[model samples]
Target chain A: MKEILLNSENYQPGLSIDCVIFGFHDNQLKVLLIKTSYDNKWSLPGGFVPIKEDIDTAAVTVLNDRTGMQGIFLRQFATFGSIKRKDPNFDSTVLDYFEIPKDAGQWFTQRFVTIGYYALVDFLKAIPQKEDNHEIIEWIDHKEVPELILDHKEILDKALHTLRIELNLMPIGYNLLPEKFTIPELQKLYETILDKKLDRRNFLRKITHIGILKKLDEKKSNVAHKAPNLYTFDKDKYEEVLKNGLNQGW
Target chain B: MKEILLNSENYQPGLSIDCVIFGFHDNQLKVLLIKTSYDNKWSLPGGFVPIKEDIDTAAVTVLNDRTGMQGIFLRQFATFGSIKRKDPNFDSTVLDYFEIPKDAGQWFTQRFVTIGYYALVDFLKAIPQKEDNHEIIEWIDHKEVPELILDHKEILDKALHTLRIELNLMPIGYNLLPEKFTIPELQKLYETILDKKLDRRNFLRKITHIGILKKLDEKKSNVAHKAPNLYTFDKDKYEEVLKNGLNQGW
Candidate 1:
């Protein structure tokens, strides 16, 4: 942990980036979190921004360093800035974890303004990397996320809010689900993200009318009930909608 | 300007806030900008965030000080942090405007990471206040916004992008329009914000289906063509939809 701090000599003193990496599996949305050595509390994958790199690049670097994933769909959602965001208690906990003297941990106590970036990745494809201090990385269900360090819980909540709003306007669900999915599976994903029950008939009608889904000639395999037809996203039509703009908010 | 800098002794050293104050008038969207005292270049209404105040509070204070309007709908959208953001030439220009010595202007030359906030206001109500260094305050049409100083233009573009996306999920148009407006007027407002021409029949159908507008018994007066029925936003219904969530991006 101390070595981690020493390696951040080129980082901007008061700015950092935190990533809320979301994935969907088993009909549940999940977020990747790391257990910090200090207090062993959970937190979003985050790191300081090096002064020489762009903030967007820094966010990508942090994501790669923590998740060992590349080319993920990432978006900068919000910036969190409060005077006491990095409280003295948290700093002391870091000092204890790193075994660094009080004076040497000044860098950890300074006021930090963190930019929040949220990424959507395929759950099975992501590989978690162990850090010097944070050796345990886990993908916690969104509903079961524990209390995180500092304002990380608030950041995660905001990321979820942003994701819900974005899902309404963009085809971002493609990043979370498998390449081929059934209508019920897609509806389940929507329900999980929105945290509400959507009318199946209406959802199916609306999604079909969007013209972004292509019906395939295949059906689900070995299902207890009737197997539903599988479909894939029409990337060209989705791109067209993105370029020509879709009618929103009905 | 030097006096202004001196008064900001309590400001956080490397952080600031910039606002994109948007208003609606004559069926056109407008943005409020201030002309710099040094080179007469236009820029967004912005200032440093005081060390003792929260970033959100600083945004409101900056908006009130520059636009003389409070309690407006202001939202922090993004943060801009590029390495060459605070070019020395710009700092020199500020120093030249303030008639400060080179050594004394060192404080002004430091790099600053700025948070971008956008405010929606009623054009007829906001009263622009003149500052010591910025005596000229102008509300230019969105399409006619001049080249702004530093990265203000990019900030303004991002603000507009956020505003367009937000308009779909939330009823924010009420903040820019009058208490009562015609359906055509509302459609035009959407068109201007979206920067695209929408099918009138489709737009009307979509807007009505949203169920947020209440038709009044009044009609537009002094019109060349047929007088359109007037309508106002149904606040309770809008809030209900927002609470329960609306089907978006169709």
Candidate 2:
């Protein structure tokens, strides 16, 4: 770790990258977390960009190092630059971790403006690097995410929020939604992604106006309410939209 | 200029902020640009972030310095950290500007991972800092944007692209779209912002599905195919969706 400072020329000081790597297995979303020997709290896989490195490539390197692989579905989502990027116990915790004098590793103590990237990967394929190395890593179910260091929890939440918004913009629904579904069922799909209730009338009106779905004569049977009209994504239109994006949005 | 490196500890090394300040006047979007003495080329209003300052605050300070005012409507759009971020002639041009030896101000020659921020300001209200001070600043119409130094043009184009996306996500059309309009007119509004023609049938279907507009019984009398029905924004629903954001998007 002391070599990090000894070879300071290789890194871009005050800037870093954090990644929220998501995986889906058994129908549950999972996030990659690592526990350093220095702290019990887990953190998103992350690292600094070298002086000549592209920020995006730096994020890829972090993911590659932890997952022991590369070419995961990745994207830049947001950059976090608030004071929150600083670990609350940094001066004591990090200095203690490095076994450096109070003033020796001032570089590590400075606030980092970190770029955030999120990736969706096949859960079964991604293997956490190793626990024997003393750096314990695991894929925690998102719902069970534990306490994290710095602003990582916030970063994770933002990535999930971005994923929800992406559900609106991208064609991820083609894989998630049923082939034929009613307006109520469609609303449920959205609600499941957001983890919140949305207004029924507005949702119906808005979904209808967006025209991604083609209403069919069939109706879903066995529902308590009136048998709602069944619909399927207008394949051509949805593809066109997933290509062009929504005309207007949030 | 030399003071930038002389007081290097005051700023975050290799990290900077660039603002694409956009203004609307006389029915055209204008962008703010500045030309320094050494460079005949124009560039977006930009500066470095201080070591201890928030990146957002650094953006505001850049806005304050150039606009000679505070509280401009600003938000970060993206961060540029590719090799293209380094000015092609940074070593020669920047060193010449500061009259420093090639070896001395190496910091100025380094690659900057700049945070991109864009501001929409009241063009008439905000005054540009004086030109006589040798910084030739102007609000150039977006269409008439001149050749810029570095990746400033890419940054500006991206800001415009983000604004187009904002037209979908933000409640901007509440003010731009007339109180009552036709579907064709609405389609035209989108095409105008995007600067490209959209397939009429697909656009109509997608726009209606988004559910932001309300169909009205009244129809335009002007000669047209079937006298298209007039429409108005579904005010309550639009406000609700805007506040919450589009259910999902790219």
Candidate 3:
């Protein structure tokens, strides 16, 4: 591959974008992670921002390229810029993995200020694909996420924090759930993202009181016990609540 | 003066920091702006982020250098990175203002991705200062702020939006008020920030119900009407509310 730093005409040398793609499945919140060619270490889907593209657009492109999903709920939450952000030995590892000369790897190792964009995608609909031959993409339970390369662990933590705060203000969790989901399923999604068990009765009372959910007559099927009523988010009501602000205490 | 882009040893070329220093005084919310040497247009107090410094620290340094305030409540809200962010004629303006050759002005006019930080400072306590001979510092009423250079107007608006959302979740308004303030004074501050007329009874009732304020026995001294009781933010209570999450809908 051509050295990006040497060819600065196309890419901004010191800037990059990392995406934390969150999805909910099996009553667990999960994040998409890729095992890199270098030492098989896991990393968030990331890439350099092209000089000509808007940063926001670049983030969306990166998300689409990595997750095989488009037009999702993607938002830039934070930027990480620490001198020690890249692992000290990362360059040498990349040099060995790419089989590139040391000089060529210099550009890849240079300090970068990465803008983080978190995305919430429907896991069942998303078709995760490997971006290149050297990497493997997989979904891992957020609670069971392994130690990530560089400062990715920090980035993931911040994404989860932003997601939790956003959950209280907006009906974004609906993006991770099916169109018609039971209250218990929705509550489980919240508990997973928040990493805490919430009182089910309180959660139901509080969420219903917000008046954003439309209770459907249908119920969950093929369940061992009594199936719970399914509900879908009322987009109009959600937007109205967002405009008026939802002060629901989580 | 040496061109920053040519002398990349000290600073990163494409990255910069812009500060939205919000202050409250005269029962009005205001932002600190700088009159630039080029076209005398106002801009947010901003400077380049040095290659050696973390982006977060650069924001704090820029805030202190511009406003003469340290250890204040400053937070990074967003980063603006549009290819069309710099005005079309900004390069020529810089060339004329700095008396630099066109070649040298290229570095000054390069596309910059500015990370925006908004600071909440007590208007009476902050001593705004000019950074250099080419700039003049002034505080303009938030509502009366004139058209600014590049996407600064958008940045300022985003900062205000973020601040409003944050006001509901955190006790950030205390940063703009004095240690001991009356209820009316505090209510006026909220009204100014939210840019709306809140019901007097409702506003007071809601704020007090949050239980983060200590209702002191003291009252306003210099007032013609009944002296409203003085109160100070109870930091401990605020922290508890923040930890438990403030779901109080405004």
True contacts kept of each: 0.77, 0.45, 0.59
Residue-by-residue lDDT tens digits, candidate 1, A1-250: 3454533346766678999999999988999998865555788888877767778889999888777788888899999988777765754666776666676666776677889999999888888887774467989999999988889999999999988877677765677888889998889988999899999898888788779998999998988888899999998997787665556532
The Cα local distance difference test for each model comes to 0.81, 0.75, 0.83
DockQ of each: 0.60, 0.31, 0.63
Any idea what lDDT model 2 has?
0.75
List TM-scores for all candidates, in order.
0.89, 0.74, 0.92
lDDT of 1 at A193: 92
Clashes of 3: 0
Top candidate, metric lDDT = 3
Task: Give a tens-digit lDDT track for model 2, residues A218-237.
Answer: 98888797788888898898
Local error of candidate 1 at residue B131 (angstroms): 1.1
Instruction: Give candidate 1's iRMS in Å, 1 decimal.
Output: 2.4
| Interface DockQ of candidate 1 | 0.60
Off by over 4 Å in 3: A1-6, A92-96, A99-103, A240-244, B1-6, B92-104, B239-245
Write down the RMSD of candidate 3 (Cα, Å): 2.5
Residue-wise C-alpha lDDT for candidate 1, range B167-222, written one tens digit per residue: 77776567788899998888898999989888899888988888999999999888
Q: 2 or 3: which has the higher TM-score?
A: 3
